[model samples]
Target: MSSRDTMLARIRTALANGPAPQPPQPDWAAPVHLPLPDAELAVTFAASFRRIGGEFFYCETLAQLGAELRAWLAERLPDDQQFYVWEPTLQALLAEAGVPFQATEAEFKAQAAIGLTSCEALVARTGSIVVAPATASGRRLSIYPDQHVVLARPSQVVAEIGDALRAVQSRYGTELPSMMSLTTGPSRTADIEKTLVLGAHGPRRLTLFLLEDDA
Candidate 1:
């Protein structure tokens, strides 16, 4: 045989003399898990999230969430700049906190500075915020804004991505949303010149507000 043909024949001979059976993948049906309290999960999630350049706030109650959120906005956003929110509960909270926001689609493109949304879960392992179509107010609110703030309850905190998936499944039954996004920190890209760039396709800042009391 020629050199190429000899090489091919050798490869075929090796394959024919290979191991009898292939190794099986680990069983995912029984995933490794331990029951964790929300307090512990919150601490782990906060550290993981902060490591990725995300801002985190823990509130003991919804009233605390409102006050802290209002203060946070006042410190960062100017009076003239627009803040947008679509979730009805969040809207009510903002109003009660005396925080100004535009809910309707009035000059959204020109005025969307910060967008606040509710989340599906807070994943502790990856410090990720899970946002699904069913949980979000609108797709644009999460992706189009300069700053994105996610409001989550302590009950929604999960230890891992799989846990988050299971929670979503339980929440929605068989009819799942079209997409579920795991947002870890801000949107970033290193494609252009191998230099890290933040907010390449989405919000520059990702802030998480975890309400520890009363979902």
Candidate 2:
């Protein structure tokens, strides 16, 4: 027999005689939990967000949120420009206010200047907003538009990324979303000549409206 064939036959005999190799067991540990007080979390998150050039606003109720949104739209955007929104209640409110918006993915990508969507969780530790594609806020809505407006309730804020992930796991159980995005602020890059530039890849502006629970 050829040397190559002899080597192959010896390997096959060894394999037949030896026991099968077992896969290694993972030494998995539970995630660490580091909880922060709510008041502290709000303050830290606001400071961090602003440091990264993100705008933050607080609203006590849905009515206040609507009013603030209307005022913001009137001041920042042209009346003729349409925004993208997926939340049904917010869409209704905008419609009532005569603000233009596109709900479909194609229309939003094609014509919308601003994208408004609800976030899955707000990470207070890093002042990041976590969004899942499986949720109302799809991948395109958060990244396509020039501006991004996020609506988040106070209860949705968590201490850190781990906490936010745990919240997702707890809510969804075994069936989790396919993808999750953690956006810290407006897209920026300092790679070009060490000078900071905004809107490097995604939205140039990020505005977060934090809804506070009624007392």
- Among these predictions, the greatest TM-score belongs to 1
TM-score of 1: 0.81
- How much is 199 displaced in model 1, in angstroms? 0.4
List candidate 2 stretches off by more than 4 Å: 1-35, 92-100
Task: Mark the 10 consecutive residues where model 1 has the least summed lDDT.
Answer: 30-39
| Tens-place lDDT digits, model 2, residues 30-57 | 4455567777887778888888889999
TM-scores of the models, in the order given: 0.81, 0.75
Using lDDT as the measure, the top candidate is: 1
lDDT of candidate 1 over 1-215, digit per residue (tens): 79999999988998999866778888887757665666699888899999999999988876787788888998877666788889898888778767778888788888888999998888898899989877537688999989998888777888999899999999999999989888999999999889999999999999988876553
Q: Indicate the TM-score of model 2.
A: 0.75
Error of 1 at 173 (Å): 1.2
Q: Cα miss at 148, model 1 (Å)?
A: 0.2
